[model samples]
Target: MTQAPDKLVQSPVVPHIVTELPGPKARAHLEFDKLWTSPSVPRAYPVVPVRGEGCTIEDIDGNLFLDFNAGIAVTSTGHCNPKVVAAIQDQAGKLIHYSADFYIPLYAEMCAELSRIAPMKEKCRAFLGNSGTEAVEGAIKLARFATKRQNIVAFLGAFHGRTYGSVSLTASKAKYHAGFGPLLPGIYHAPFGHVADLKWFDEVLFKHLVPADEVAAIIVEPIQGEGGYLVPEDGFLQGLRKICDDNGILLISDEVQAGAGRTGKMWSIQNWDVEPDIIATAKGIASGMPLGAFIARESLMTKWGPGAHGTTYGGNPLACAAAIETIKQLEGGLMANATARGNQLMTGLREIQKKHPGLVKDVRGIGLMIGVEFDSHEHAAAVEWASFQRGVLALEAGMTVVRISPPLVITEAEAATGLRLFGEAVAEVAAKG
Candidate 1:
C-alpha cells in the first residue's frame, strides 16, 4: 500500500533506432573491448550501451532501446535513478571507503535495514560482501560453521555464482564446470521444484551418498534463475523447509536473482511463506552498486568469532548509501509497480504464445521475473536476436527461455510497447522457422 514517489517520470519515446545496431561507434568500442577484455566475458548482443535512464537505454550509436533485461535485473529502481544518484553523491562526498575491521556508520545502518526487512521471524544479523557469489560463499561458511556439518545440498539448474565455492554449488550448465575440476566435496545436487523430490534427499541422497546428519544446509533459489525463470509447484518450498527442520540442517535461500522486489515482495521466498535460516542476496539490492549480503538469525550469526570471515570493499559507504535509497524507493511503490507491469507483460506474452503454440512451449514466472520458453534453444536464441533487432533488449535464461526482467519503474505504457515489440520478434522468428 505504499505510494509511489511523485518524482517518477512519465514514459518516454523508446526503442528508437537512429542507426543500425552495433553502429559505427559501437563497432569501434567492440573491437577495442575484444583486445583488452577477457575472452570469458559473455557478450549477448552488439548493442554497446553508453547511458540509460528508467526503462530506456542508448547505445554508443544514436539507437535507443527499451531495456527489458535491466542489466540482468541488477537495476531495480531504474538506470541512473535520480534519488539513488543523489544518495551516492552525498555519501561519496562524506566518505567513500572504510574497511570492515573499523567502524563504518553506513555499514551498520545498512545491516540494520537488512535486519528489518529480512523474511525470518527471529531477529537477524548480516555479513556484507561484494557480489552474489561472495554472499553465497559466506552463507555456505556460516551454515557449516553453525551446524558443524560438512555436507551441503543444492539444486540442478541453479546458478548461484562463478566463484570457487558458489560455482561448486552450481549445476545449471556443464560449460560452467568444463575446465574446473574437483569441485568442493560434500556438495550434492537434488531435483528442484517438487514435493516428491524432497523424498530423494532422504531415500537416495542420504541412504546412498551422504547422510542427513552430515548435511550442513540446503541452498536453493525460491524461483530458479539462470537455469530458467521456473516457479516451483505449490508446497515445494514448504517441503524443503520441513526437510531442513527434520534434519537439523539450515535452510538457505539464494535470493541473489529473485529478491529485492523483483517478485513483488521484499524477497522471493516470501511468496512461499516459508522462513529460511539464512538469505543470500545481491544483484538488485543496491541499485547497481557492488554489494551483497547473507543475513542470518541473530542467535546463529553471533556464534561466529571475530576474524572468522571479513571483506575490505564489501560494505563500502557509497554502496550502502545507494542501497538505503533503493530500499526506500522499493517501499515507496516500485514493488507494486513491478507486480502491475509484470502481470501486463505476462498476460501479453501468453497471447503471443497462443499465436505460435509450437514455438513457445511455456510462459511462466512471478511478478517481473518471467521466462518465455521455446521449443528449442535455437528458436529461443532467434527470438531473442529478433527482439534485440527491434530495439527491445532481453536476455536468455536456461537453454531455451528468454527472460523478461525490466526495471521496476517501467510504466504500463512502456511494458505494453515492449510486449508489442516482443510479439513482433516472436512472430518474425516463428515465420522463419
Candidate 2:
C-alpha cells in the first residue's frame, strides 16, 4: 500500500481571493474557449483552475477555492497527490503508451489487483478503457457476447455514458439524446431505486414489451451519479440481484461514480452485500488519469472470443502504474477517512438543512458521495453559484439536487470549512426567499 500522505491543510495561507470570481484571466480564457471549443459543454461557474493541490484549486485569476466537485469526483487521492504523481512520473519515464491488446506487466498486475478487491466471490477478469463511458460500452458488448442476447435493462435517471451504446442506456436527461437520434435498439429503461418498478417489469413489461430470455443484462449505478447522488434504500440492489439470477441475466454495477473507495467501502455495491456479475469502474480509479475498467466473473468474461473487444490506449502503463498507487492510498488511509469525513460532512449538512428548512429540503448519500436537494431547481442552482462565490466548489445534480463529492483524502477541517461555506450559500439562497 502507498504510504499515507501528510494530512492536508484546510486553511489557505495565501489569500484565497483578491479579485472578483473569474477575474480577467478567466474571462479572457472563456472568450478564447468560446471561439474554439464546442458550445455543448456546460459551465457551472467561470472559475478556470490552472493549478490544484489537495482539496484546494487556484484558478487562472488567482482565486482559490475548496474543490468539492473533485473534477466530477474523478480525483480520489486529491489533486496531484505526491504518491500518485510519483508513480505516474516513474512510469512515463519508462513507457508512455502500448496498445492494451499486447501484453504489459502492469496491465496484468492491475487486473489481478482488481480481482483481489472485487465484490464478487468468483474470480474476475477485466478490460481497461479511457473513461467511464468506454467502460460502459465495453460492458454492453461483453454482456451480449457472453449471454448471446440482445436486450439490456437500464434505470431511469441513470447516466451510464454519452457514447452510442452507453448513451442509449442513459436516461438522465433528454438533452443528452436530443440531437443524437435512433439510438441502439433493444434497450429498456425502468425507475431507479424503486423495487416495485422491477416487479412491474417482471410482470408487465417483461410479458408485453421484452422477453426475459432475450435480456442480456441489467446495468445500474449502485449510487446514481449525474442523475443525482441518490443512494438507494436497503435491499433495492439485492432485489435486482435476485431478479437477474431468476432470469439468467447478468447484473452490471456502474461503479464509475461510486466506487474506488468513495462510498466507505471498496465498492458501493459492497454496501448492499450483493455481488454483481459485472462491475464498471472509473472516475476515482487512477487519481485523475484517464482510466476506466469493467471487471466481470471469469466464468462470464472468458467466453468473449479473442480480439472481440480491444482498445489502443485503454491500459496505458502510466495509468496502470498510477492506479496501483491510487489503490494503495485508498486502502491505506483515504477509505477510512472518507467514511469519517463523509459522516462529518453529512451531519453538518443535515444541521444546515435544519437551519434552512425551506431551502434545503433533503440531505442524502453515503460516505463522501452526498447530495442536498432543494424544493426547486432554481434554489439548487442558486445555492451552487452562491457556494462558488463563498470560495467553495460544488456541482448540481438532476434538477433540484446539489452534489458534494470531495476527494477521498479530504480532512475533517476541510469538511467543516466546506460545509460552513455550503451553509452560508444555503443561507444566502434562503434569504432570497
lDDT of 1 by residue, 1-433 (tens): 1222333223357888877776778877878888998999877888777678888887776677999999999999999999999999998899889787899999999999999999898999998998999999999999999999999999999999998899999999999888998889889899999887778987899899988999999999999999999899999999999999898999999999999999999999999899999999999999999999999999999988999999999989999999999999999999999899999999999999999999999999999999999999999999999999999999999999999999999999999999999999999998998
Provide TM-scores for the models: 0.97, 0.96
After TM-score superposition, the amount by which residue 422's alpha carbon in candidate 1 deviates from its true location, in angstroms, is: 0.2
Predicted structure 2: lDDT: 0.89
Kindly report which residue pairs in candidate 1 clash with one another.
Answer: none
lDDT of each: 0.92, 0.89
Please tell me which predicted candidate would have the highest lDDT against the true structure. 1
User: Tens digit of lDDT per residue, candidate 2, span 1-433?
Assistant: 1222344333444226757876777778888888987887887888787777988887776667889999999889999999899999998999898787788899999988888889898989888888999999999899999999999999889999888999999999999999899999999898888666668677776988988999999999999989978888787899999989989999999999999999999899998899999999998999999989999999998997788998899988989998999999899989999999999999999999999888888999999999999999999999999998888999999999999999998988889889888888999889989
Angstrom error of the Cα, residue 396, model 2: value is: 0.3
In model 2, the clashing pairs are none
